[model samples]
Every structure is written in C-alpha cells, then in structure tokens.
Target: MKTKVLGLCAASLLICAAPVATFAQPVAPTPPPHVRESIYVPVRDGTKLAVNIYRPAENGRAATGKRPVIFVFTPYRARYRETDGKVVEAALNDQLALASLIRAGYVVAVADIRGKGASFGHRRGFQDRTEARDGYDLVEWLARRPFSDGKVGMIGCSYLGGTTFHTASTAPPSLKAVFIGASDLDKYDFVRAGGITAQFNTRPDEPPSVDLASLPVDGDEEGTQLRAAVAEHAANTPMAPLWYGMPNRDSVSPLTGNAFWQEAGVYAYMDAIKRAGIATYFWGNLKDEPTGQTLFGATNLGSKFLAGPGSHCVPPQGFDFTGEVVRYFDHYLKGVDNGIDREPRATYWLEGSNGYVRSDQLPGVESRPLPWFLTGGKAGRQLGAAPGVAGTAAFTVDYKLPPAEYFGFWPQPMDKHGLSFTSRPVTAPMTLVGFPVAHLTVTSTSPDADLFVYLDQIDAKGKAEVISFGRLKLSHRKLAEAPYKNFGLPWHSGLTKDLLPLAPGEKAAVSMTLTPVSRIVPAGARLRFTIAGADPRQRNLKDIQITPPPRIGVLHGGRDPSRIELPLAR
Candidate 1:
C-alpha cells in the first residue's frame, strides 16, 4: 500500500531473532563512465540526506551518467566525517550488488539519512514521516537532475531492509520498488520478541549497545561528533507524535541520543502501512535462528519472533543479493520484465543437516499451537493437551543473589537458576511457534524475585539446546506496566503486570515468553523448560539487594499448576 507521510521523523523497535550465514553474488556488470562519484542532495525538511550517485559502469572504473536511480538510505552515517568516505567507498564501490546495479544501466544513490555522517538534520527513525519524506524528496529531487532517469527503487537488509518497509509504506510517485531482506514488518515484533525484552548478543555481549548515558553531551567533543544526531528540537515524550506517529518530546535525556525514542514498535502501525500498500521482497535469515539482521550501523525493528539466521545488521550468510534484490528494483523501477514478480514470494535457508531450502512463503510449514500445564511442585512439568487443572508450579532459591542468564540463552537443557521437573520425551515430533506462557505461583524471600524460564528441546541424540528464555521482577507483578526507562521510554509489560511477589510458600502466575521456532524435535526428543532465577547470559536489571543472605522460596501445586504453551506444526 502506498501512502504519503513526512519522512525520518519517527523510529520503531527492532527484530533481533535471526540466523547466520554469508554468500556474495556473481559480479558480471561493470559501471558506465561519467557518473559523478559523490553528489549531495537536499531534502525539503532542511535535512540534507547525503547521496553518492554511481553510473552504469559495465566495465569502466568510474561513472557515465543518465541511468535509472537505485537508492539505498540509511540512518547510520553513510561515510566517516574526515575519511572522505574512503573506507565506505573502498568497501562498497565494488560491492557486487551496487556494481551490478550500475552495470545494469542504473545510477545508484547511497545516501546517509539526515542527522548522521555527511547528512545534516535531527536523527528521527523510519517509523516517522521524516524518513519517508527524506526518501521521497531525495528521489523527486534526483529524478529532475540531469543524471537521473526519473525513477527510483530501493534495496537493503536489516535496518536498510526496514527502511524499504518504511519507504514502501509511503509509496511516492517516483518510488517504484524495494527489495527487503531479513527484516520484521512491525517495530514491536522486532524490538520485543513474543512480548519480552531483547537480549542482543551476537556482536556485543558487553554493555548493551544503546547506552545513552555514555553519549557525549551537546557541547562535548563526542557530542559534537553526534551533532548530526541531536534533533534540532525535541519531540513528544513517552507517546507517539501526531502525524508521524512518533513521540517527539524528549521523555528521556538526549545526551545518550534518546535510546528510548525508537520504542514505537512498527507492529502497531502495520495496518496504516498496509493500507499504504507498499509491495516488498521479504527475505529471512539463515534458519530463522533467533537473531535477526539489521545493518550494523542502522536502527532495526527489534523483533526475535521474525528473526532468522541473519545478524542484527547484516545477513548471517551473505547472498547473491546482486541477482535477487537488484533484479527486483530493475524490474519494478526500470520497467524491465525481469520476471522477478513471478518468483516465489519468499526464500529461506533450511537447517536440517542439509543446506537452505528455497520456499514460497515464510511459515514454510504448517504449525499449530500446543498447550501444557505446570503442576505446583518443584518439577514444573508439562501436562500435554489434557485439560489444564487449576494448578501451580512452585519453587525456592537463594534470593540473596540472582543467576546470570537473566533472559537470553543458557548452558544445559535449560537455565539452572531455580528448579525443574520434566515429562517423558514426546512420543512424536513436535514444534512450537508461539509464546510459551508461564502461569506460575512464586515468591521471594525479599518480597521480590525474577522468575526465569528457558524453554528447550532435547534431541534424539540426547543433547539439550535452549530455544528461548525469559524473566520478570516481582515488584512489577501487580503493576499494569513496566516502570524503568532505557533512555526514559517505558518497556513493554504483560508478564510483569501479572507477577506476584512470593514469601515462603507464596504462589502466583507470571507468564514468561519463550522464543518462537519451526524445528523438528524428534519423537525421542523431549520438550523441556527450566524455570530458574537467571541464565549466564543475562544482566540483572532489577537491583534486588538483600542484607542477610536467605534462600528464595516458591512452591508449586500439581492440580492448579503453572504450564508452558507450545505451538505444534505437526
């Protein structure tokens, strides 16, 4: 659906669940001569979105003009300030995709989004009209220039991929097409997986990447470097802005560049964008692992459910994107019948001991929802399909200190923070593709506790691998919302809303969301979950301090039990 909106004003959540793999395309085309190397373009908003136009060089080293414009916009500064984009130029100049597009009679426009690098303006996100406006303004402006063919198309993966969605939604007159790879359609799905916080671990296992507190102030040298990022003014706070649907005010401090500003998850606005009617070429990661890709420097729609094998910024395994993504633009914007629209709607890599298996749609296979029950006892067992009894799962631990795996992956079959009890292996294969709800009755020695859940699969070979895990602070149990601010934006809450603090023998239901997946847990393979206080990979956010060390106690009742609901594809 094509609709118009101001551009680059708002930002959204990210999708981090993806697979890993890499593959480049076959380089055959050479660019034409005469295409100017670097040409800056201005957007209507006073934000100059920097663009480098490349000519169709089938065999030449430099440019020759007059070709269709293929545009790639990014929030990350396109080039370094002083390096003269040398590093970016050297790396991307010969990139198979860009070079091929040039060779195919296309003038490529690689621009840095406003407020970053060469471009100047406030740093808004794709979820806003500013980005769309910036893109549309760039294309319309470029089309009239002597070098452009009056048509523009887009291509990129991860954050760049996300931009395609943003651009497509704002289908402008000059905007013809886009090639989206490994990205989530909604911001919430990308940012919050299955209704929980993200554990972005691929590249940085250290201090979370969006550390606003570490950002330089407005006058500091470091802040000067981010002058482009600083908005000319603040927008709304803790609320989405008016037209662009983003919160414009600085609910949080900007010294950290408003890390919480991107929380307007894209999922909530899909209906509006869908009504905009932007067609896209959606690509998933390697095996839909759990970490999705967004270009390293760009902002992504944080989602784990939609993630595949790709990394946060790039694909897990690179692709012959030159053929696929470029061809998409060539056909739609260039008026060439490249037969791209005739290809399968989706493509993916299968992880069954075999390589990738190309397919038509993303779900790839039929999957159904599975429900299990948790009896109130130490074991946190699963009650298959049987009607759930009014029961509960209970446990106790050393609440003085929490375990690490706060809410990501774990070592063994599951997180070992609390206690676990498993049922016999499934008699048949099973797969779950939805959130595993944790209806638990638990409490802590200190009036608060974080219930961690690690859902896993034990293969026929007798090895356990973690599929997904989650956690919640007890104080947040009765609250309708989360009370902390990462850059001042409130985090999503439903699990915490239901959390009930535990005293000895205290019981309550706190639902913990697990990762979604399409895998074959063979009959001999057992579906398991470990309800602990933490995993080794997580950083405890709740500053729970206990003066005198005491054990964390929680009890489970088999009749009215706590259970995890699994989605079955078989």
Candidate 2:
C-alpha cells in the first residue's frame, strides 16, 4: 500500500486533505443526463434559502417521473465562486459521489443555511433551534415538490452532518433516512470536552469574501440577490464569544441568554429522533471526535455505524465505503431488499492489522478490561499486571511543550517533556478494540492542573507511536452518570456544580477515558502510558497558571493506585 500524509484543517469537523491510498476507489455509475436549476426556498419565517437542484433529465428537459429526494443542508454555500472564476457546488465536497447518487435516480438538492451562504436572515447561533426548524420546513417543502416522490433523505459531513441530526430531531414526517459523517451529537461535549476548551471551536467565523463570495442564483445577472444575502450575514451572531463564554453545559450564552449548548446539541432531542424512526447511518473515523458519538447513536438509536481509521473526516488510505452508503440509501429510501438491515450493526477498522471487523453490536460488549498498574521500579517507572511497592514519581509542569502537528496524530519524540511508564514486552499478539480508561492518583502544588495522557505502542527497536490520548482538567475530575448510554465508560458532567478544585499538595484521584482505538499489539512490543501537564493543541480559557511552575506527583502501588484499563477484544 502506498503511504500518504494527511494534513488536518482547523474547521469544526477538522476536514483533512485527501490522501492517495491503495484501496479501490468507488467507480461512479454512468450518470443520466441531469438538469441543474437554482431557486429560493422560503421557510416558515419567510427567509429565502438558496437551493440548487439536480434532477434526471430526458431529451434536454427534466424527467417527468417522481423519485426520492436526497437533501443536503449546509452552512457552507450551496454554490460558490471558485478561484478560477467558475461557480460550482460547494456543499458536497465530492461531486463524483453526488453524481453517482443522482445517477441512481435520486433527485439531489443542496441548500444554503440561513446566514452563511446565499440565504437571507442572520444566524442566531451555531446549529440553533431556528436552523433546525428551517430544516423541517425544507424537508417538507422538498417532499411536496412536483418531481419529488414524497420521500426525503439527508446526507452530509461535518457541519452539514450536524444539520441532518438537527433536522432529524424535529421528526419531519417526510424525512425518512439520513447519512451523517464526522458530526458531534453533543455540542457541549465537543466544544468543552473534559472541561478543556477546543481552540478551533472558539475561533472567529471567517465566511467567504471577495473573489470567493457566494454565487448568485440563476437569472441574477447583476448578482443583486447574492449581495443582499451577504449583507444580512454581516449581522450574524459571532460564534466565538458565545462558545468561549459558556464554560459549562448549562451556562447561558451571552448573545441569546439561553443554554445554547444544550439546545444546539442533537443529544437533547434524541428521543424525538427515535420517535421519528428515521433510518440512520453514521460514518466516523476512530481518530476523529465523532467515533464515540457514532457509537452512542448506534447503541441507543439503532443506527448503523462505520468506524474507520483516519484523522478527522478522512478515511484510511485505500478504504472506501461509498458502496455501503449507496446500499444503505437503496434499502431505506427506495425500499430495496438489499439486506443491509440484516448486516452487522457496527463495522470498524483495525490499525495494525489493516483490516475491518464487524459486530452485531457496538464495540466493547465482547471485550474484557485489562488493567495495567503504574508502578515505580529501580529501572524507572513501569506498568505491571499488579500493584508494586508504594512509591511516587515527580515531574514539573512544562507549559512550553511543543504541540503535536496534525491534531496530535503525527508522532513526536516521547520522554522529552512528560513522565512515562513502560510495560513489559508482550509474549503474544493482543488486540485492543475500545476506549482506554486512565486512573491516576496525583498531587499537584497548584490548586488545579490539566493532565494530558497518551497511550503509545513501542516496538522492540525502541520506536514509539501514539495510538490514542485523553485529557482532563483536574477541577473537572468529578464524575457523573451519563444522561445516555455511554458503554460504561467514565463520564465527566462538565457542569459548574460538578467542579471540584483540589487542595494544594493534596492527593486526588482522576479517571478519564481516552479516545477509542482498535489496534493489534505484536509480540515483543511494549505499551507505554505517558502523562504530561499540558498540550498546546487545546486551550483552557479558565486554566490557572501559577507564578512558579507546579510540581505534580503521581502516587501509586497502594490505596491510591494509578493504572490504565485497556479493552482487550475477546
């Protein structure tokens, strides 16, 4: 297989540049001649949403038959002026994929959300209730259109994917199925996960301007309508202040005085979606933020999940699941007897093995927890099956540690900044297939400190590569029962009321679950659990910085044992 380096973008979904891989790419079906039309779709509030429709054509005219409509609701412009001065579809990144669906006899519609695109009206907040209601209106409208078969399905990635969940939550009658990729179900958890603020979430919104402005709909020769829409976007609410101001899930937004996070998240309306009984397919990358969210939806809402290896929205090199996507839509939208409903509920990619695993249920149910205790030895710190003699290892906080590139997926040299605990080489191959929980008994000179834990696989040659990582703000260490099914993993409420500040020089037990991973550890390879004070990738606006660097001590062996629990596949 050819090797490729993926570059991560700092968007909400963290889109990655496409990398050439050896996997067979999906070949598009020979497309039927299609007629493209641009028009305005008016919603409940009379706000005009810009929509582009691609319909199967015959003899240079739109076909006269009704077909299921596939809809894409996006904040990104439905169509935008490219640098080459040509207007093109901007919502769906892959035109070939869109064309394939169109070739399959589906009428594809792409719409600009309320503010960001060539649509009138300003955004209240990111994925707010109004936008969701607009989705309901749009879906119903598309179903009622002349050529529509009265069945509507949604498909998108990133923000567009989030819109699908938001729309599905409203339980629109005509909306039947949805395919979502790289979307966060819990907006609060994504923005301030583990009580650490994501820097990208707090960055200012930078809409397209100048040469890359939103394209005007057909018949707007002077670009009058597009210019007017851009004007209204000027009044759109700034997302940074709203995100930065809300420290807790229940915190009110400064702009709207509402619990924006709660209202914006699909988690709040999961029941509504379940009641709607929409067929759902979630595509997530194991190295991305949406894997856990995908598992949660699959377990709770009976959705099908495709978990693959890659950073952000990019799939592993050579791994293409577009054929499965077509199968899903055919089964649900067209009522085809494709037997997709009888297939495995979850499918995931294994890293070291470079293969896929299918399960009747979400991962972790058929796995056993393998605990490795952090123990101190004469040959430095080590991870063992049982607790060793009581001991403590000290490390000073390092604020200047360089951040890992590619959102921490790119490997960096270890032992340069943080304390490391290495496990003895394994005798046989072992497959770890789920979340890894870290339990640390620590004492810090400061009242609170951030703990960044990394799980690495080390070969006999002494080369180490990061597998997965997790972080927690010491003050947010208080665990709470999750509101939904969370696979029995550690849950931190991230609520202001649940915050617990540690006393100076006092021992505190912190437990956090690292991001999910699936990898096979070869025999003669060792596992290393490394803990650092800070990672420059994420920022905490409320982090307490002491005048002098604080010293953190990890207490282990007895009473307050520090260990990592790995989910070994059964």
Q: Give the number of the best model, judged by TM-score.
A: 2
Stretches of candidate 2 above 4 Å error? 1-21, 24-32, 90-96, 207-212, 315-320, 403-415, 539-546
For candidate 1, the per-residue lDDT at 222 reads: 57
Clashing residue pairs in candidate 2 are: 23-318
Worst 10 residues of 2 by lDDT: 8-17
Candidate 2 lDDT, 84-146, residue by residue in tens: 876656423343256667767788899989887788888999989999999999999999999
Name the lDDT of candidate 2.
0.78
Q: Candidate 2: lDDT of 225?
A: 86
Error of 1 at 561 (Å): 3.4
- The true-versus-predicted C-alpha distance at residue 310 of model 1, in Å, is 4.9
Predictions in order: lDDT: 0.47, 0.78
Name model 1 segments beyond 4 Å from true: 1-36, 58-66, 80-86, 90-96, 122-132, 181-263, 267-272, 286-310, 313-321, 353-361, 375-414, 421-452, 460-463, 470-507, 510-513, 534-560
| RMSD, one per candidate, in order | 10.5, 6.2
